[model samples]
Target: MKTQKNFRPFVAAIAAALLGGALAGCAPLLVGGAAVGTALMVTDRRTSGAQIDDEAIELRSASRLREAFGDRAHINVNSYNRQVLLTGEVPSEAAKQQAEQIVGRVDNVRGIVNELAVMAPTTLPQRSGDTLITGKVRASFVDASDLQANAFRVVTERGSVYLMGRVSQREADRATSIARQIAGVQRVVRIFEVVDATDLRQLAPVSTGTPATVAPAPAPAPAAAPAGGAVVTPVR
Candidate 1:
């Protein structure tokens, strides 16, 4: 009877150990899934529109990148999910390399994919307002074309517009005019490299990607202000 009692205790210990090992194996997967879900939720809550939010972030990052390079004369920035894609013409390979370096240094960037053309700098205003104009024109293109819509990225820095992706020159030209027509648009910049217009696809948002279905992560409270006013970019 004492042996039987001791056996029962050993069995219980073995069971516990197995259970612990199983949970340990699942822990990393669970943690990873939670983190990804949290990030997506945070991204969704922070922006009013996903595409618009992406464009704004891209524009802002592009501006910062150009400034950082100190050669804002050329270059356009497009952002999708923290990945920045630069497309446009630069005067030299050195300049092209510099643009990549500058964009990589920006905070929150997952990666930089530069498609900047190395050629004579085309006449385009690389100003903030110009980039805005470019975005407006791209929006018009989306409204008019039967294309997947999100397949194209439009970026304007100054008055120059850079269109990136596998788009026809006709499509790019149309996009350019759209930007030029917008008010406060000084000049229209075109840095589009035309290619086969096919093979573009847009990823459908997850079935549960809807705002209400996913709960946003709770943001920490803001820190106390320093002795002097300091400027900080909002996460959104």
Candidate 2:
């Protein structure tokens, strides 16, 4: 329960570690008493090792992306349990496919949700709006007593909201509905690794949460993504 007060990991993730000192507020498990990283691991569905790997995956894939596209693309690489979700803008279709191909080569990456749009990078105002929308969505999750805010990871890009995490089918639908109600959300995407209720209980036996995490969603069709889940990723 102590860690609940510091439940803003989404902000850190969405900002792609660029929040710097701002993230320090939630990074510590104490103020928060425990190691901040340790605190997150306690509640995260991914094992501590997976959490670490996710970080590495993001860093490695991002470095590759930057090398491949430089200032031409605006990509945000988010790795949750080693399933990387790529969001942002690129100049061409070739750039988009190249981005996915580059990320797919990263070590430990089991799959990818390539949500990169073939367009120019968004302006600061638009990105700032996306940040605010992300904040509002996160606040809504916290306000929802039925859900564990930290159980979800949110990404808002150009009004579209993405949800990601390991959760139950009921949690997925509930979380989706919650996100869709947010005023500025253009759409809600589900990149959830939906688990059986029995398995969810096994992960957190005392958890009574009714909603899950956010990943970029589709507006009209399923992505060409491989659509893998937590089960096949093979980790603790």
**By TM-score, how accurate is candidate 2?**
0.74
Off by more than 4 A, model 2: 1-36, 204-236
lDDT scores of the candidates, listed in order? 0.42, 0.64
Q: Where does candidate 2 have its weakest 10-residue lDDT segment?
A: 25-34
Could you give candidate 1's per-residue lDDT for residues 1-236 as a string of tens digits? 99998676445534533332321111100110111234443433223244444544555555665555545335546544444556556777887788777766665555555656776544533333443454455445555654433334444433434444334445554554454565655444333334334521222231211111111213322111111111111122
TM-score of 1: 0.35
**C-alpha TM-scores of all predictions:** 0.35, 0.74
lDDT of model 2 at residue 167? 73
The lDDT leader among the candidates is 2
Clashing residue pairs in candidate 1 (N, C-alpha, C atoms within 3 angstroms): 125-159, 125-160, 126-157, 126-158, 127-157, 127-158, 130-158, 131-156, 161-189
